[model samples]
Target: MSASMPQKRYYRQRAHSNPMADHTFDYPVCPEEMDWSQLYPHFFSPMDERHDRDPDKGKHGVEFADVGCGYGGLLVELSRLFPEKLILGLEIRVKVSDYVQDRIKSLRAAEPGHYQNIACLRSNAMKYLPNFFTKGQGMVYTMTDVEEVHLWMVKHFTEHPLFCQVAEEDLVNDIIISRLGTCTEEGKKVQRNGGKNFLAVFRRVEDECK
Candidate 1:
């Protein structure tokens, strides 16, 4: 009976053994094995410049998107300039992306509304831009309004999507050909020359939000 009791005890201990002990670990993080190429390719490369040709094509001044922002300098500037405008910076590289995130955090703490308008996200801006802004609906501000000295200190901006559509070349011609299109009336301007340049503002004919 004593021998049988000892065998029973051994079997009981083996039966109750931890199931996780025999399981194999998938992997351990190794510094040398890390694929940094897949992580931070853009960290060393110069960031591509993004030009939003038709700035007024999206939703009104509720949000602002800084596409392909490197180190988020422009985003920070926009935040300071327009505290009420919600700003988002998109970057692709892992290290730089993390850096921008930390910057926004610190800025938010230092100034009350300094970083309130800004944020950073790791993403491919080109691919995700459409996701953020609909066809005829995005935050847009008139260059004239932005250039206003009085509105510089104003925390909030009145939301208006309306603006005159003008090409940068036409603006130059308006200055040179007609002596700043000086003699010409508002609706009676002639096309003296044409070239591609930044489209400052365009009227939103239809509300995509509707």
Candidate 2:
């Protein structure tokens, strides 16, 4: 009699990948990298009641950002309103980014101060938000996804002790913050009349304090 041993078989599979993925664009880079003057040309004055701007300067600086700036229009207006605060616009599309870059160049040349406080960058906002924001370092401002940034703020602010110390009043006086498709119906109504054009408020609350 002879003893039999079990045989084991191994299988291997080829990798599934796309060649274009390697050269894909990363949106939402930091504010300092790109020049807004070469991206957005027209400046809309917020005080004129036609555009959007964070009127509370005593609360935050011009060091704000727009994570997914579609056309760089909002950033232009923001620059005019908060000339002291440095504004950053982050976009992913190569065509749009290039257009904004050129627009900003023309705007700056036409009116030097039109974009004096503005800049732009191209990167993925979701991945780089934490890196861009450092514990109450700057007055975080945006009109992008409310739920996304809200959660990010709550989490980031909790992790970073410096963020927890921000004053409520200071937050209130920070900016006229709002988002698209947030209150979709009401937002559209306002945008239609060119009155306010957006909804904004300052929310500086501690969700999980340590």
Candidate 3:
């Protein structure tokens, strides 16, 4: 995702949403105030109001997010492959979001650590990207499937010893510094006569480059 220098911008309000899976137009005034313990209680300790009130004490947060995640199929797939990465699915529909939450619970009960890193939440991702994700982790896409680019990236990342391919569980044995996204195509206005959405997956060495 290409981002221009930071500048103040105004966003229009979205007043309409599906009532079946209705959502409230609420968001954090700032990222620090957002409590992630509700999303992944097992991973982090309960919030201490004293610590939470301190501006310097931030709670544990998700490193990966699936915006507009429908039924959470992709997140379910990712849970097995990237078991150590904290992943969250954002769904606008209430019922759908609840289902994903339950799905994760069942999977965890069946096999404990298989799903400790996955979670889901109900929110309007298009409007509240910053509320749940930090600037470096939030990924928005503008292009569709580009196989040539994917192939080249895979080759480059694989050749680099710091990075490894994520094809099965236990993909990352060591503590990671940071990770990039899968081939993402959230924004593709003009498609190639007949093109499909894309997803990308890559991780870079931390402290290597900003």
Which residue ranges in model 2 land beyond 4 Å of their true spot? 1-62, 130-133, 139-175, 178-210
The worst-scoring run of ten residues by lDDT in candidate 3 lies at 177-186
Candidate 1, position 155, lDDT: 23
Collision count for each candidate, in order: 7, 16, 6
Q: What is the lDDT of residue 141 in candidate 1?
A: 29
Question: What's the lDDT for residue 66 in model 3?
Answer: 73
Clashes of 3: 6
Cα lDDT of model 3 by residue, 1-210, tens digit: 222321112212242356445457566776776666676555654456434333432334576677666566667666666765678888776666666787777777777656777888878776787775665553222222467766666677678866545442433442221111221122222243456434334444442322
Question: Per-residue lDDT tens digits of candidate 1, residues 1-210?
Answer: 011111222212121223233433222143223222221221112123222223432114226665545456666666666665556776655555566676666665565435555676666544445554445555332221123432432222323444334344545643222221222221122224432111243335353321
Give stretches of model 1 more than 4 Å off.
1-62, 138-165, 169-210
* Tens digits of lDDT, candidate 2, 69-134: 645667766766777666777666555555556656666677645566676666555556554554
lDDT of 3: 0.56
TM-score of each: 0.40, 0.47, 0.53
Best by TM-score: 3
- lDDT for model 2, on a 0 to 1 scale? 0.49
Candidate 2 minimal-lDDT segment of 10 residues: 6-15
Ranking by TM-score: 3, 2, 1
